[model samples]
Target: MDHRPPTIKEIARQLNVSVSTVSRALSDHPRIGLQTRLRVQQLARELNYEPNTQAIFFKQKKTYVIGVVLPFIREEFFSQAISGMETAAMAHEYTILFGQSYDDTERERKVVAAMKKQRVDGLIISLAKETRRFDHLQALESTGTPVVYFDRVPPFAEAHKVYCNMYQGTAELVGWLYGRGYKRVALINGPEKMPASRERLNGYIEGVSRKKHKVDMQLVETTDFSRDSTYRAMEKLLSLKHPPVAIISFNDYVHMDAVQYAHRQGVAVNKDIVFVSYANLPITSYTAFPPIASIEQYPYGQGEKAMDLLIQVLNEKGLPDAGTRYYCEELAPTLVMH
Candidate 1:
């Protein structure tokens, strides 16, 4: 009446052989004779016997499972990135343990702790928006569990990371806008504490300088990425004596919010005020006012590369220089015109 799956011990008992003989025969060991191997295999198939992968993994000290933590799963960018991670993991006979931080540092810490408790082979993470301290991630590396970060990575240089180089793309966007005779440009950036915000600001400055335009702080605004905050930023820009003809947003989400606010004020999107942003997401196409152009950050490539890097780290764990090794990749963002 027992419903449990047949085990090696049961197989051995049925064949009147030792457990080692059954195990060796199932593995096609050379020491086991042909007849015994065939008999054990036939019985295994008939009884629906399956190898206990958990026991094998325990003996090997490897789970063949990786943890992936991102800020938000609903965001198309993160979803595409995870898809790339999944594809790469499958090619290596591994699988992902997925978690979402919802942009909260506390939630990210809890998810990471849970993954560690599960003893994942390694971890790939895109940091939460509010994560400033990396002690939690550092603890994992100290325990010999490799961690690779992608997209929203930490500011440190010692960590393994893969990310998009947005500076060049943002600069290119400025030059592109200038070419179209939109000399007065502005930017709607994210929280000042974020590294991404700094990258976009630097690029905006460089772009303006390249066109012989003086950097104007009055034209720039920072938003918390909330709808009300985006509306306030839009209002500030519109109140300028000479408003910018083109505005570069932090990302597609911010662009959507800013565009909606602009519409309420009768500002013609892509005409009276042209808008451009990053993360060339497909969802933007359906928005009432999509950006005239966007920077392709290649989230999928970032995710794949991050996973591949983590796998490499896991492979080289015991090597002499593995402890000192670090991998950092910065993919150049491309500006895509809509």
Candidate 2:
């Protein structure tokens, strides 16, 4: 009735009914008999009365786009996961936007807010290393945006995900190291705030501290995922009064960092240090000297699975609010020693 681009008023005049009745019937108010509501709806449809999306927002606002928030996609592992999401999105004909939180809590919050303002219908997220709280993630889900977490999700946070069976890889890697006669092994760990860090550390501890060959707790050095941090941590460990003859690094990325650190310290990688990196990315093989071995967790495959899971979630009318949906794969590892 505001004389804008035609609305219910014109429809009501054509149907010979009060504007209030048209509005109520259009809304399918239960108090108004079903037959009356049906007739009004039928007429509205016939007239092609396009309900103003703004009006709908005024009532129940929703946007159909999706946002994918990642800590950093610089790693090939993340690249694969993103591919999976893109493949699934293409199939569904849905558009996706990306946000890199860069491990800063404030930056992460800003990205989340931006996605909320854009009214994304869903989210696919991998928390930053610094994220210790799930309140922001939970709030978005509460608003009806389906969120599927992947990779480095919080330990206590319940959500859907696709990840690697780190324990399996660790057991295999550590068992091999012990077999190679590297008993006094050391672990250069990643940032404690990261899920992968804890998972990897747990696997290392459980694997080495078994029926045989127990690792020394003092040999473990905590560091960030960056090459510089890894190098620094490795330096501290190597400077130990009795340095470990073998080092099991966090991942291939960190493995490269550790390798470089050893090189700088006038030590040969395989010959002197006997290094092994978790998550054997192709980049690892191309290192100046390939690590003793690396667990080949196919990020490309993981990414594909992530997309598949997201599609399933989007297909479902309503996903369960409680419980978690997780898929973890333990793929074969390749030990390519130089």
Best by TM-score: 1
Off by over 4 Å in 2: 1-64, 319-338
lDDT of 1 at 97: 99
**Model 1 lDDT vs. the true structure?**
0.92
Q: What does candidate 2's lDDT look like per residue over 44-148, in tens digits?
A: 787677877666655754444569888777878777778877877777766678899987777988999899888877787888888888888889877767677
Each model's TM-score, in the order given? Answer: 0.96, 0.76
Residue 20 displacement (Å), model 2 = 23
Q: After superposition, how far is residue 169 of candidate 1 from its true place, in Å?
A: 1.5
Clash totals for all models, in order?
Answer: 0, 0
Candidate 1 C-alpha lDDT tens digits along 1-338: 99999999999999899999999999999999999999999999999999999999999899999999998899999999999999989989999999999989999999999999999999999988778999999999899899999988888899999998877888888999999999999999988888888888999999999998899999899998888998899999999999999999998999999998899898888999999999999999998889999999998888889888899889998999999989999998998998
Screening candidate 1 with a backbone cut-off below 3 angstroms (N, C-alpha, C), the clashing residue pairs are none
The lDDT for every candidate, in the order shown, is 0.92, 0.75
